[model samples]
Target: MLLAQRLPQAGTRPSWPRRLRAWLPAVPALLFLVVFFVVPVVEILQGGLYNADGVLSTAQFARMTHTPVYAKVMLTTFWIAFLTAALSVVLGYPIAYLLARLTARARERWLLWIMLPFWTSYLVKTYAWMLLLSKTGVLTTIASHLGLIADTSTLAPSMMGVLIGMVHAMLPLAVMTMLPIMQGINTQLVQAAETLGADRATGFFTIFLPLSEPGAAAAGLLVFITSLGFFIVPALLGSPKESMIAQLVISSVLELFDLRFAGALSTVLLLCSILVFYVYDRVVGLSSLSGDAPRPKGGQGGRALPVLLAIGRAAGKLHFHRAGRVPGNRGLKLYTWAAVLLLVLPIAFVVPLAFTRSPFVAFPPDLFSLKWFGAFLSSAVWQAALWRSLAVGFSTAVLALALGFGATLALSRMSGRYSKPLFAMFIAPLIVPRIVIAVGLLYLFARLGLTGSDAGLVIGHTVLAIPYVVVTLSASFKRFDWRLDDAAKMLGASGFTRVRTVLLPLLASSLGAAFLFAFIVSFDDLTIAIFVSGGLNTTLPKQMWDDIQLAVTPTLAAVATSLVFLVAFVVWLSSYFKRHSY
Candidate 1:
């Protein structure tokens, strides 16, 4: 009776210490982000609000508003981002749709091709576009030979070039974003619609399209936000008139030496991104990114449904009247294959160009030679950059995985209102622009005397990598069978023993994948490296950026080709392990 009285009641709340203990595991990761990510970003944003004397003022914002060039640049930035998002969605929808119809194995195989461009370094891809769109390049040569144009002065340094590069970069992402939602859709609904006297077009438009809207919306939002911070594509392929807000921010810092203006520019960009994210969350729900259908809120179905249904009815009316006719499948397949080809073309072109005897990066070599590859191998600068990238990537992956694993595990064990907000906080890095983070880190690292150091690069990359790690582990945890743990516990296994023998074994593949993703994120990073390297510590991407800006040579192509092969091998090895592990 005394023991029963000593026990807490069923409805009694846990003690404060118990609640605090529940959050203990997550504290390290939370503190890390608060210190490195949140503090730096907040400080930079605050910089924009204060004057040179540290007095709070709106002069920076006033300058942006009053300056015609700044206003034009901001407008141009949004317009380009909007177009990139729209085009990526439009071009990627069919590919995602085709993949959705395939079997799991086939889908996985096709995704290999789709993900190649995504895995390739942005610098490599941008360089490849430069080669293709140059005056004496492959495409221009072909066009010239075919008598399509009288002038052969190249198609680059134009908005068309900018769009091509940006869209190519973003298309794979769009396809990936929409694929999960499309796969979760019930094709049976489309079949039912067809059975009820609707044509194929009508069924797809009314049922499948409506169901896929959330994914499309999510992709658009994500792509637009990502595009806003793009400096590489525009800098390489676009003229000054096509300069983006990111370019202006870069110029303000590097060329103008105006930290205040850079901060103000970053503030505007950050606020715009946050505003867009907020609207997307309220409307489509950010959960759409995870393939979950959002609950319909009030007024969600008001006019959009009627408009979509009307479009479906019109498409149905225009359908060709033929028995057993499955329209668009063949076309979709061909389109998907073409898209795959586009994704691989640049990488394919770079490989052969790496072996060219010519000094320049041009297609159709006069003779084959390995001189450029030899140059790359023998150059101390190149070797240093390569090793530095590997080191930073390794460090970033380890740090991110450790932090993400602990935080994810803690969140998985807890069930409360706090979980959602914490998860959102963890993933905020993904939503925020990379350029903003880069500039912010530059400011913070400068004050701490950590700028231009390997540690700075690792810290910045880890911030970027944590989001990918958290998201990957979160999904893996959700799909895990907790019953195994329960069974092990009932069998008298200790917590350590169960985790070591059961949980770790079951989650090994996911952990490896998350590590690989984090590594790749760090390795492929240029924005952070550009700001953090400070010309003292050069990463592979930073080296490539310098070479591309100063001089484009066959050696650059050789380096790019090597990176492609390395990334491909890594991806293949990962796939092999995953396949054999099962």
Candidate 2:
């Protein structure tokens, strides 16, 4: 009888208190983005408009476009990224397919194969490439010995070699990002097409291909962005013809010492990368590559051959269950083993090269010595850079971790769809080339007298590493149970105490992994460190970079060997701590 009267109620919108509760978690993140991300970018774009004379001018901008070299270099940068992205897509897809389709145990074992080279230092990884592709390097000597090439000159520095090494560096990341998405796809979709008389080609093109495009495009985006900022790989392994924007940026800074022009150059490089990335997103939506299957068994990559024929074998076994029917099972298994070996070949050259007595790299060494190691450890120039690298690396890690945690913690409790969008905003630095961020920071910092200083390098690196921390921490956050925090609050705890005692304790693995990963990324970085720090704070990677370009010797190899072990140790410790924890 009172139904009509009940219809007069007012709007049920959340009150200010509820809105405040909902928005609280976002405050810290918003503040950080505004301060570090937005401000730096604004200053960078505005850099060319002003000069050291305290007056505005277009001299820097005019200087940038006056010559065709930068323009050519910019074009070169784009194509390299495109080529690198294409190469990674081809090599990474098959490996990712294996990991996604294979047993859980196989997946674990395969990751060791995927990660062994990747977990090694980036510069060390590049040095390993140096050994494999040198004039008398392992690959060249073998090809000549087998009469595959006329001489060792065939494998010497060129664009092709640069692309190959860059692909090697970028492939692991592409596979890791793509595998999970591939795993999430149900294996049955392709089988259904096959049973409907769709042949292998038809099934792949119409069904699986469209489904997996998101991961492919995303991985491609990542490769392209990362490749744009590549300094060490090309600097060490390629010749002058392949000089990229990163090389140009470094020249403007170190060679020319024209801070204004260098900042302008960085601005251009950054803009071009963003333009290409924007086009990629227009072509393929990024959100589609969001998820994938987690660990399967034995490492998923170990069953490339067997995943081709699971059902029949599953029926044959008395205990057959999950993998009852999959094709190419045995062949897939064989292929998986081959895949692992293929991944290892490039980096495996280091073992022999390290022990060689030749001052320069050679195959089937006539001698062995530890002299290089001794030199690497004792050289004042290298030792100073090494110490500097550790200090900057640790600081960069801590800074990134703090910024990431603040943002992630604020974003974690948000209930609105804005959270996803906010997370994407935080992810912008990663997808945009480091060239852009570095340039932006260079321009901004110079005005503040921070350029080429330790503080400047720290700011630049932390900008890059923040995204790494955010990605890892976000995953940990998604898995967290809110009840524990609530439980802590109910028992009488302040927000900081709850975070310290409850949140931090629960996220130890994520924190540790993020820190180590952040350190690795910052340590391995050469592009930003090169321009932003000048020679004042040469990170280990930048030092190796200069050493490689100036000359290659056993001393570089000595440094490479030590870095390999350092990186491997950290990764092992991270995993160990994860396994031992609750």
Candidate 3:
């Protein structure tokens, strides 16, 4: 009778209480996201769909459609974003390929250069570009000296300048995304093709290129989605005609005081972003972004093989052939060096300008001085902003790590049916535009009296930071040997003891990496600070924005240089932990 009772449940599911208990570890993170991210975003979308009297209406959306200026801005935003993604992918592919071919140690050395701009503050990079692209700036002066253009010609305040800055900002991200996929490609496939009488160019084009398409496509999608919400680069580097939808949304709120209209604009952007994300998820799977090899559907590559082979034949025909000869490696190395130079040139210029004696931010200083650094050190406002950023960044790192660790652990134990959806939910913050999150939180925080408070800043930054934490931790957890926990348990260790001794020690490197990423995300944030800080309590990035808008001086350069050093120190510390963690 007891056997019958146990066997009789063949068609039945687990009890509701049992299922609920299974998800208990994830409850805290789920609740946090629901309260801070989902609820606020829904409220913002609702605001756009209703009038002041709370009656249902679409007047705001109607206004958006009917206004020619708004229409132009939407078109411009998409166009620029599309171009940025396309160019970033194209330009980053060679670098990713080169890095993929290098030895691990050599690749790491090169990656430091690639990631330098990524670690530097976006505001700092933008300002450096400003100095470089200005009429009398370094690039223009150099070009004029070489007779590349008239002495008065400049790059800034134009679409060309906007593209240059945007592509520069996104190139590192594209390379990082593609490099993993490229590295995973089997070199044997190309060697086999060459052994079968195919030339090197033919083998690379027919086999390697097709294999790397997924990575390139993934990189393009990510860059495009990220570029859609960019306001800082466009606002600073381009003219009014180049205004993006994000800029418009900011204007509607701060300048026009039209919350309803701003909500509508954000809604349009949110929907577009969601649509793109949906398409990417269906085609490549969102898991690709987190380092999973996306499964290509059956017959997908078969359909493209013929076209690729044809292209390969054409490429082979164009290759210059000589007896016992192959192309030189020096061209690839030169291209890589040039790309690295472009990435570091702006920061290199800004550092020197920071130490210049001139009050003006000139590239070649007449004399060296430390007055700008002194100014930054002595200013009460700068000190407060720096401290505020550090505090919020640390708090955000702790909170995000706690939530992400629990959620990731819970997900590891859950079934795929339950876990995949939850994983998607966790990473959704990354897909949604920062401006949308910022605008939604601004409304939610205002009603809760949390604006201008440090707690509010921490919460906002934590929401953004959690995705990074989850991604970093998930990669480590995927490869972790869970049997260690079982071994500890078998030795009569309790849950807490097993976690403290077995899990923590094993995962220290990943934990440190996750913590550093979360901290950097919060530290470099400007969108959330602009909305949640309310100008009264500013973070470092927000303060920099205010200062830059008010006046451009050597002081800004000094601040940028300081930030570069801080990031360098943080990176060095992370490396130290990694080296010693074992």
Candidate 4:
């Protein structure tokens, strides 16, 4: 009894041994991030502050702060980001609203429509736009005939074209982000407002709008951040005079060979991104981005809520549509369907162009043939790039799945205090602009003699792919029952044996999904690969980027078509495996 009294109390001090055991799984992932992610970022920062001779200096920042050209480019980038975010919200809001209000079956169908373009390659989508807006392209020729413009030359490489392409690429992301929050909103509350006295428009403006602020904020943040790092669309669609910040960063490194200048540009861009993220976090909380934020408590709206409800009720007597069969407002359907069409129009335009034999990117070709498809498959250059992409994608998926699985497992066992910060660290790469990450990695890899090598591309792609793996696996892990493993342990099973017998079998489907997601992410990546990959290791997107600059070719159209089929098949396979997992 005296010895027991002298010992520490059971809850007073945590056991170090238990804590260390829980943290052990996360060590490998944390170390991987330290070497590949954090160290490179630090190197970029140091490069911005130091000279080539290894002495501390700031002369390299001359272009960013002192040059008028850099300032103009930065402004243009911000302008585009702002406009893109605003436009996405405008185009996406109605569809998201419709999605939230529709029946389950309708919602699934419309959601599939929105997600189809999202699954396709970004470069391919941009190429589609290039074809549509080109001199002899379908839309351009029709517009010319209709007196909309003199020719396609007026629109092909303009700022308007860039904005259109960017919005098309980003609208799905905005809609997806906002849809969850809108769906989570208690429809009953809106109905209660209607039953009391409110109309649809008034209810939407006063009640729904205010509550959806968090989702709106998140959507805007995601769109703007992605816009800031856009390279392929702007480079392909916009004129030289209208280059964005990312274009300048690329030029600084690839054209000028000015590593220090490129580092400075990246640091500035990174700082801007961090500042925006921090402010948004403080106001709305990062949980909004994941669509899991807690609902606000009731009775806090005061007199304003009831007053708005009264106005809505007074307006409720006036019916807007007499032919309505859908459950929600009919007026919204017009805008929502138009937005959906806008989203799919480029896809509709590009798929048929693959078989055309007009010798140019003309729609409704004079003749149809399989010539381009054969050319893409047979050409040594195209074949080499395609093989490289497949190899890198496979390696990236394996590495990311391994690391992300370890991190997710560790988090599943971790307490709140340790898990949240670690989770943020894991996702930081996603939030940081890709251009900044690419430039930083380029500097670090060049210094370590890893540039132009398969190992380097794999490492870079893994860093990009890991976040998706973590997100997918974490959700799956949370849904899983760990008690099965405990029961196995109770039966005298070893740790590895429990994992192999219980966890792995149960999680096999999720593992496959995560692997495919990583593969697609690595395969679609162009921003990072453009900066990191070289002549020998050129990936498909980089090859296409080069080809586009030289001339628009039918082979590109064929390749884009093939990528679509590939992505769709993978998605279908993933779904089939998941359904059969039981």
Give all TM-scores, in the order shown: 0.94, 0.82, 0.93, 0.89
Q: Candidate 4 — which pairs collide? A: 197-313, 198-312, 198-313, 199-312
* Per-residue lDDT of 79 in model 3: 100
lDDT of 3 by residue, 1-582 (tens): 333335325437567755675687678889999999999889889989999999999999989889999999999999999999999999999889889888977887788778777778889999998988889877767888999877777788789889999999999999999998888888999989889988887887788888887788889888998898899999999999999999998888889999899898899888998899888778777667776666678747635678989988987887633322223346667888999899888877788888888888665775689999999989999999999999999999999999998788777767878988999889888888999999999889999999999999999999998888887788778878776776775677976797789878888998997898899999999999988987776999999998898887999989999999888777776665555554
Candidate 2 wrong stretches, greater than 4 Å: 1-30, 48-68, 145-149, 188-205, 280-327, 330-336, 358-360, 366-368, 487-494, 534-537, 577-582
Q: Give a tens-digit lDDT track for model 4, residues 356-473.
A: 8778776565557899999999999999999999999999999999999888888888887888788878877888889888888887888889888888889998888888888778
The digit string of per-residue lDDT tens for model 1 on 1-582 reads 333334324327667655575577678889999998899889878999999999999899999889999999999999999999999999999899999998887887888888778889989999999999778777767877888755745668778889999999999999998998898888899889878888887887777888888889989988999999999999999999999999988889889989888999999989999999999888788777666666667746524677889987887677643432334667778889999999999778888888988877655765689999999989999999999999999999999998998788777767647776788778888888999999999999999998999999999999999888887787778878777776776677976797689877888888888888899999999999988987855999999998899988999999999999988876775565455443
Model 2: worst 10 consecutive residues (lDDT sum): 1-10
lDDT of 2 by residue, 392-500 (tens): 8899999888878977886776653666577767777787667667766666776789877888777778877877888878778867887777677667787789989
Judged by TM-score, which candidate is best?
1
Give lDDT: candidate 4, residue 528. 76
* TM-score for predicted model 3 compared with the true structure: 0.93
Error of 2 at 266 (Å): 2.9
Q: What is the lDDT of residue 138 in candidate 1?
A: 79
Ranking by TM-score: 1, 3, 4, 2
